[model samples]
Target: MGKIPKNRDEALWTLAEWNLSKPEWQHFYSPQLKSDMMIRIAKEWKLDGVMLHYNRGCEGLSLGIAENRLAIAKAGIPVMTFEGNMGDEREFDEARTMDRIDAFMETMGLKRELLHA
Candidate 1:
């Protein structure tokens, strides 16, 4: 893993390692602003899908599951939520996760071939 930067400038420099250019820099810097920007990018790139992780541990930072689902659906893409605790094995229930994913795929009419690998 790369070292976490101590400040914003150092963080931007570190992002350069991932080939992110200065013109594209603003997107990485501000996440609250990034959602709308990403919706625009999705349309511009002709993307067929979007996913939002309604993470358990990071619930404070994440848009709540209902709103996230609504936003993605409004963008005309299928959205699914998987509940998993970051870095906590005890909180990650694989069976429940798979069930939610399966139900979501079924409701969205996603083919088993497309979803199951």
Candidate 2:
């Protein structure tokens, strides 16, 4: 009645088409694609480390994230993950995220240098 068609028959067909067309975790997908993409990006940019934000709010985007982390590590890239919600501020923990980031930087042999005037 709101977004769908007023007719039940038409609504059924529209909903089916929408569900079938979704490329999310509902469909057959290869995690290797995301793994390969991360690997290529790291190599291309010569990145010292990769930080993956596990957005709790977005299930579709985070589907292959764990596998991607493993694959990136296997490919000899330093990677780390932090969990938080991208859309909701209440779901994010600033202190915990900062701690994980600090650990990641330390693992990468990175240290903050104090700026002097």
Candidate 3:
């Protein structure tokens, strides 16, 4: 098949493989790796930021967004999340989403210019 990652430990494995040392694995095997790998990839591609859908219905998935947010923030990246159902626009509050986004961006200094630029 395609080229496999040289480090198998970094490859996505079962949840059992993810243990108390997950952060250690990330730091050693792939320092670039994070819970927000998708957002990190988008940022590496020079995108402005990442918008995560924090679905209220998906409790398991949404539970880790806060940790992911913290990790992404440590990487000097911006993330904005909105609370809503997967396919129900009626449940999406635009104003609240905008408020969160604005606050996140501000906190990340996304609106600031580079000191040298």
TM-score for all models, in order of appearance: 0.53, 0.71, 0.50
The TM-score measured for candidate 3 stands at 0.50
Error of 3 at 49 (Å): 1.8
CA-only RMSD, every prediction? 8.9, 9.9, 8.8
- Pairs clashing in candidate 2? none
Write down the worst ten-residue block by lDDT for model 2.
Answer: 20-29
Candidate 1 global lDDT: 0.63
Cα-lDDT of candidate 2: 0.78
* Candidate 2 lDDT, 1-117, residue by residue in tens: 247587989889888756654445332365776677678879999999899989888877788889989999999999999998888989988999887887778777766441111
> Tens digits of per-residue lDDT for model 1 on 37-115?
5566678987666655656676454544455456557778766666677757688888987787777777767766788
Cα error, candidate 3, residue 2 (Å): 11
Per-residue CA lDDT of model 3 for 13-86, tens digit only, reads 43435652365444334423446465557677986667777787766556566667667767666667778976
Best by lDDT: 2
Span of ten consecutive residues with least summed lDDT in model 1: 21-30
How do all the candidates rank in terms of TM-score, highest first? 2, 1, 3
Off by over 4 Å in 3: 1-36, 102-117
Order the candidate numbers by lDDT, best to worst: 2, 1, 3
Per TM-score, the best of the predicted structures is 2
User: Residue 30 in model 3: shift from native, Å?
Assistant: 14
